[model samples]
Each structure stands twice: as structure tokens, then as C-alpha cells.
Target: MSEKILELKNISKSFSNLIANDGVDFDLKKGEVHALLGENGAGKTTLMNILYGIYKPDAGEIFLEGKKIDISSPRDAIENGIGMIQQHFSLVPSFSVVQNVALGLKELGIIPDLSKVRKRIVELSNRYKINVDPGAKIWQLSAGEQQRVEIIKLLYVKSKIMILDEPTAILTPQEAKGLFETIREMTANGASVIFISHKLKEVLEISDRVTVLRHGKVIGTVETKGSNENDLARMMVGRDVVLKIDKKPSHPSKPILKIENLHVIGDKGIEAVKGVSLEVKGGEILGIAGVEGNGQRELGEAIYGLRNYTGNIFINGSKVRSGDVLERIKNHVAYIPQDRKADALCGGLPVYKNLFIKAFSSPVFSFNPYLFYPEKLRKPAEKLVKEFSISTSSVDQEVKFLSGGNMQKVVLAREIESEPKLIIAVHPTRGLDVGAEEFVYNVLLAQKERGTAILLIAGDLYEIFNLSDRVGVLYEGQIIGYSEPDESHIEEIGLMMAGVKNEDKI
Candidate 1:
């Protein structure tokens, strides 16, 4: 048997009243890619945090190279050749890659040698095929490039054990493939990796061994070659999980949302959406498929009254007022923004408060002039929590403590419960697990059955083809192609997404 590089025995952790991880055992062999598989709130992140010394285990023993050791702080972990790259990066936007890597190096004196750092970065980048530029600022790089910088930083520290949390959540398919290659290179050089991801397909493709966690206990660990996605899903969720969505044929009614000759400028003072026209009818989903930063954000914002635009936007046959979010809400427009952290929920507030934030003005929750009843808010919140199957202890629990899947559920529960006529859902299931994604699809379909028009903007082609009645491809701020979701039209849609129009190709 190969040498065990790291091991955790009976590891446990808690946050206040929440038992994040029960007695759990995990181990990694040298040069092996060990995957941690679980649903949201399944204690995967908690276990990894303990391994990285971000949290001290309440009860457990850690072993490095067959010798018991203590990892009480990040410095201790780093000293022991362990490093972690979290889902949210820690790089400064304005700093260059080398500078970011050298920020906390104790050995590098106040006047550190920049040339040495750059050379080391280049060496690592070339070794792993990470393809990062040492002199480029963090903000100037794409999401994939930024991820490379994080990996390079870990390598620069001479880490033998790397823990990556949700590494491919925001990456494109091509970018994910590149990252998989880099992982192979790292493992080939005798380094171990603990990859935590909700993507089952990637797990099967990349991991040598997979461990499943549920609630706070270890379900089982299996060799990847013998297990399929079904087996993994069953182990993680404790039940058979549905990976595909089933929906009846869409019977679109009269138009509910109409945009004609819409033009909008991006934050960079350039026209991001140009003369785009589309209509979403009642009881239909119009999915826009495109790469990231292809003006989908601007289009969604313009319709939701969050951005200034020159055009006609009619919701329910009435012209929407420009830059009036509240008025759009009054007209029964519910928008689920792409950035849930910044645009959707207030992290500091309780789940119940966020659930009823938009409904406070309604008569049901208001008691007197300029006053609101807490009891009224609590009742509805309790009902929504139950209906949505949110995994929080109580409605009063802060949303920040919930998992990404649960936070998305809260956003969906709040928006869908309002009985809106028009729904603008942007990457609604971006970071959610398979179970939560199924729940989101079911909710959207239920709303569609109630005659709501939905504009679904997403980067995932599978999602676009799954639920969209009509698919439109957006490229460089233009609606390049439109077609029904049929097998024959997929290749054409792909070409359009790459900015190649059918006519242009001809």
C-alpha cells in the first residue's frame, strides 16, 4: 500500500447549536486525488476546514506521515506543508500575481526580491500548465486565470497537501478541463489533493477515491472506478436522486414581457446590450445561452429597472418605467440576480426577515401607519420555510450561516411566493447541488403552470436545453440566433454562442 500522507480520526466540529461535523474519519494517500462528496450542509467544508486548521476539531486526532500532530492555526498547517484554496478567493484585485503570492511570506524580508518570486511563479505555472502571468493584476485576469493564481500560491508555499473547496463551481467547461489536467500534474509529482465539489461527473472523472458525507456522518468511501453517479448520489443524499427534469410541453399564451430595440451601456462605459429584441410569453421559459460577460447581465438589469436603457419594455402590456425597481416590483416582476450574495439576500439579517423583505409594504404584514407586526412576518416565514424545505434550524437563523443551496432556496421561496406575472431568473441553480437544482426546476415549472413568463439566462447549456421552450444565443451584446430546443438546432446554437451567425457561416 502507498504511504498515507494525511489522516483524520473521529473529527468533529460545531457552530453554536449546529453540529457541523460528527465523528468522522478521512485519510489521503500520497499522490492520490481524494474527493469529498456531499450535498450542501453535509459537513464536507467543515471537515476540510478542520484539516486546514481554520477550525479546531472538538474531538479527533490528525496524523501526517504516520505521526500524530497538532494543527491549531493556519501558520501551523502551512508549516506542515498543507494549504487550502477556498471557493471565494483571497487575492487583492489591484495586486499582481507575484505580489499576491509574496504578501504573507515570512522568509521574504520587507524588501523582498521580486525577480525571484516571479521566477518561482513562472516555474510552477509551467510545471502545472496553470498558464498565469506573473505581472498581470488579479482583476485583469479571467475567473480561470485567477484560479490558477490561487493554485500557484499554494505550490509556491511548497505545500504537499492541497485542499480545494468548490474549485470548478464558476469555471467554464474548457476551463474545468484545463484544471483537471493541472490536478493530474500535481498528483504525479507526489502531492495529495482533497477536492470538494458538488459536480458528480467531474468527481468521477478526476478523483481516484471518493468519500460521501450526509448530515454530519460519513456514509461510505468507495473507489471511483467501481461506482457510478447513481451510487454516489445515493450515498450522499441517503436516497435515490433525480438528475433529469420532466416537464410537459409549453403552451405559451400572449406575451407577458416585450423588449424592442433595447440598448444599454455596461459599467465600462461601452455598449454591452445593443438593439436586442425578444418577447417572453405567459407560461413559457425563454432561455438565453451565452458565455459569461456577453451582455446578459445588462439585459437582465435593464428589464428589472436596475440599469438605464433606451427602448420599450412592456410587462403585462404596460411600458415599464426606467430605473424604477420598486415600480417593476409593483408590476409583478420578480428578479433573481446572478450574484446572490451582493444582489439578493442580506447576510446579516435572519432568514425570516429576508423572506418578507419585499412584503413588508403589503397589508398582511403591516399593522398600523409606518408600523409592521413581527408575528405576521413570522407566520408567513414559517410557512415558506416548511414549503421550501430550507435546512436551517429556525426562521430566525441568520442566512449567512446557511449553505449555498439553502440560501438560494430562500431567494426562490421569497420571490416565487409573491405570485409574480414575470420572472427573471439568472443562473438560478449555478452553485446548487443536484437535489437543490431539482427543487429549483420544480418551483420554476410550478410558476410557469400558473401562467408566469420566465426569462432564464444561464451559462450552462444543459440547463438552457432542459427547460427552455425557445432558446436564444447571445454573443457580443447581440441576439445572434433563436430556435426551439430541438436536437437538430443544438449545433447551430453552439455556433451562435461562439459569435458565428448561420448566415455568416454560409
Candidate 2:
């Protein structure tokens, strides 16, 4: 085994009443890819934050190269040959990759030399097989390209220890494979990596070793050679987890959602959804599979009437006007947006309020039509909290304080209980564990059985195949192909997801 390059001893952290990390110990060997696996609120992110100097450990010691080190800030960590690539890119959309790479360099003097920066960026990118146009604007690049730029920025700083958080969350299968190859190249060149992700398959493929955490404590660490998904899932969840969901065949009814020649303009003022047409029938799930930045968000927003678009959108055979959010809601359209924290819930408010938002203006819950009624919502809110199995002290607790899984349950319970005719769920199970993922699957399937039309846009193909009756591959803002989710179509669907166009099946 290689020498230990980094070590954390008895690490502990807490946020309010939550014990994020409890007396944890972790180490990374030289030139090794060490994967950290855990459930939501299981302290994976918190532990990485401590290593990257984003958070101070309540109790612990960090040792680097056999010597204790103090990492009080990100600057200190960077100075000590450590760098982190966060799940969300922190690059400026208007600036080029070269500019973003050299944004905060004390060594670059008063003015950074643009040519030198660009040359280094290209050289590092090429060396690690992280292809990117340094001069291209961040907004103009795809999600995968932007991720490569982030890696290049870290490599340019000569970082010896790298931390990647949910690195392939937005990447396609091909992109993820390429990323694993890049990690191999980086580690082969003597860089140690702390890989944190929820994707178990990729973790097994990339990491030299795996560590599972549960309930803010280290469950166990094992070699990747003999490890399997079932084992890791069991460790993380403390029991045997049913990875596969039991979904019955769909019995299609009349089309609940129909899009005709829809063209949506993205946030950047470009036509994102170009002449797209599809139908999601009642009692069926139409999964839209795509790599991120391929009109998925824009199409979803358009379908929910949150964004303006050209063409016809019909909900329950009634035309929903473009950009009419309330009209779509009145038409019984429930939207579980991609970013739940930012879009779905009010973090400052309690759980019940988040659930009560949809019926705020409805006459069923409102007496004076414009009056605030907290008491009238408590019973329903408590009922949902219990039904959804959401772990919280009370429904009055702040929504932000709950774990990611519980928060998603709040979103699901609210959307499902409203009994919408159509539900648009985008990446609904983004960072959940296998246990939580199973729960989400069961909820969606129950809704399907209840005859609610669902349009699911997700990056995980496994999820697409598990619940979707029919799958549509969206590449570069168009539906390239459609297929029934099966072993025979996996390869073809994967190809279409990577922009290889084929004939539409449905």
C-alpha cells in the first residue's frame, strides 16, 4: 500500500442539534482514489468541507505528509496543495475559462497575463484529457465542459490533494466514464483524491477503497475489489436495501400532457427547446433522459408555465397559456423542480407552510380568500408529515433544518396530496441514498397507479428505466429517440443520450 498522504483523526462537527460528524477518522493514500459513501445527513459533505477548510472541525486533528496542519480557510488549504471541485460550478457565466482560472491568484501580481494563463489551461486540460475551450464563455459551454474547466482550474494551481463532490451528478454515462479516466490520469500522476458521491457503481469503478458512513459515524471501510452495491448500500442504510423497485405495467389513458411544436427560450435568450412535441398519458410516466444543459430545465419550466414559450401546451385537453403559472396550477400541474432548496420550498418557513403553499389561494383552506390561516393547516400538515414518514421534531420546525430526503418528501407529499393531473419531476432523487431513493420510487409508482400523468427528466438512466414506462432521450434540445425501458434498448438509449439521434419510437 502507498503511504498515507492525508489523515483526519477523531474528526467531529455539529450544526445546531445535528451531529454532522461524530468522532470520525479517515485517511487517503498517495495517488489513490478514496471514495466516501453515505446517506443524506450522514456527514459525507461535512467531512469533505472540513478537509477542504470550508468548515472548522469541532474536535479533530488533520495531518498532511506526517505533519499536523491547520486549515482555517480555503486559501490555506489551496496554499497547502489542496483544491476542491464543488457540485455546483463557481465560475462566472460571462467570463471565459482562462479568466475564471486566474481569478484569485496572488502569484499573478496586479494583472494576470492572459496568454500565459490560457496556455497553461490548455496544456493542463490536454494532459488530463479534460478538453475545454479556454476562451469560451462559461454560459456558452455545456455542463460537462464547464466541469472540465473546474478541474483544469484546480490542476493549474498544482494541487496535490483533490476533493470532488458529486462530480458526475450532472454528467451522462459517457461523460462519467471519461471523468473516471481523467481521475485515473490525475491520480497516476501522483495526486491523491477524496471522491464523494452517491453513485455506487461509479464509486466501485473508480475508487481504490470505499468508506461508508451512517448517522454521522463511520460504519466501515472496505477494499473496492470485492465490494458490491448491495454491501455498500447495506452499510450505509444499516439493513438489506432493495435496489430494484417493483413497478407494475402502465395502463394508459387519454393524454394528460401534450406539447405541440414547442420552442422555449432559455435564460440566455437562446431557443433551447426547438420544435419539440411529446405526449404523457394519464396513468403513465414519460421519462426524459438527458445530460444537463440540454433543454430539460427550459422544457420543464415551459410545461409548468413558469417560462414563456412558443407553441401549444395542453393540460388535461385544456390549453394552458404560456407563462401563466397560476393557470397551470389551476389545470392541476404539480412541479418538483430540479433544485428543491431554491425552487420548491421556503427554507425559512416551517414544513406545514411549504406543504400549504399550493392551497394558499384555494377556497378549501382559505376563509376570507386573502387571509392567513395557520391553524387550519396544522392538521393536514401533521397528517402529511406522519404519512410521508418525514423525520422532524414537529411540522413547525424550519424546512431547511430537515435532511435532503425529508425535504424531498415534503415536496412529494405536497405535490401528491394535491392530486394533480400531471406531475413534472426533474432529478427528483438527486442526492438521496438507496433507501430514500426506494421511497421516492414507491411514491411515484403509487401516483402512477392513481392515474397521474408524470413527465420525469433525470440524469440517472437507472432511474429512468426503473419507473418510466417509455423513455425519451433529449439531446441538444430535441427528443432524439424513444424506447421502452429494457435491456435491449439500454445501449441505444445511452447512445441517444450522448447526442446520437435515432428514430422516435412513440
TM-score of each: 0.95, 0.92
Tally clashes: model 1.
Answer: 0
User: CA lDDT of 263 in candidate 2?
Assistant: 96
Q: Candidate 1 residues 307-376, lDDT tens each?
A: 9999899999989887889888789899998878778899999999999888766666555655756777
> Residue by residue across 1-506, what tens digits does model 2's lDDT show?
47999999999998766788999999999999999998876888788889889999999999999999999999999999999988767999999888999898778988789899988887888889887898899998877889998888889888999999888876877789989989999999999999988888889899999988887899998999998999999988888988888779999999999999999999888889998999999999999988778899999999998899999999998888999998987888899998788789999999989998988768765567657778889898999988877767688889987766678788988987898889999998876778878888998998899999999999888898889999998988899888888667887887897787675433
Reference-based lDDT, each prediction: 0.88, 0.88
* TM-score, structure 2 vs. true: 0.92
- Tell me, what's the RMSD of every candidate? 2.0, 2.7
